[model samples]
Target: MKNKIVAALLAFFLGIFGVHKFYLGENLGGILYLLFSWTFIPGFLAFFDFLGLLLMSDQAFNAKFNPGIPYSVLDGSRSAQDITVALSQLKKLYDQDAITAEEYEEKRRKLLNEL
Candidate 1:
């Protein structure tokens, strides 16, 4: 919500520089906007982004804003011990048939990749 507010205010005042895009966590978009703003593209883009933020549904907003950052690792990436414990629990759940093989494999893959 705060990001949206910042984007709105930036759009109102500095839309030409695409500062609004940066506030919305769009680094690439912000860079593009910054580079081409003087050509009028970013001004038009910022106007649309502003309208989208105001009128778009939550699902769309989430889809757009989702960095997919894990809350579990917010304090810093979880230690290997933590991942090991989680993987062990998942193994037990799979063995008990509480979760499907596909789910188990998917989670295992994610955990391995984290290491």
Candidate 2:
């Protein structure tokens, strides 16, 4: 998973060459930055991008960059066993009135689908 901190650092340090843009999969923007690097405009723009990256929320960053699965899920390193345990935990929660039946069913469906 791409880290926000890493991306921000790239923008702050090597932004003059648009390294961060390339890391972010913005090939067109990276090319443009490379083309204008001689004018130092890319450097200034990269500074702003660095600030923006720092200010952006994790959810927004994940939605834009990671898509589908969030970084939190990837970071958990869940295997099939882990997913099974989680499903069991959800069932226990439902049985104990911690979660509603609909919530339990919905989460269970999602977990099963992942398998």
Question: On residues 40-100, what C-alpha lDDT tens digit does candidate 2 reach at each position?
Answer: 9999999999999999998888889888774547565566776888899998999899989
lDDT of 1 by residue, 20-94 (tens): 877777678888889997799788877877776767764455556654534355434787987998899999999
For every candidate structure, what is the RMSD over all alpha carbons to the true structure, in angstroms?
11.3, 10.9
lDDT of each: 0.76, 0.89
List runs of model 1 lying over 4 Å from the truth: 66-115
**Which prediction has the highest lDDT against the true structure?**
2
Worst 10 residues of 1 by lDDT: 67-76
| Candidate 2, residue 37: how far the Cα is off, in Å | 0.4
| TM-score between candidate 1 and the true structure | 0.48
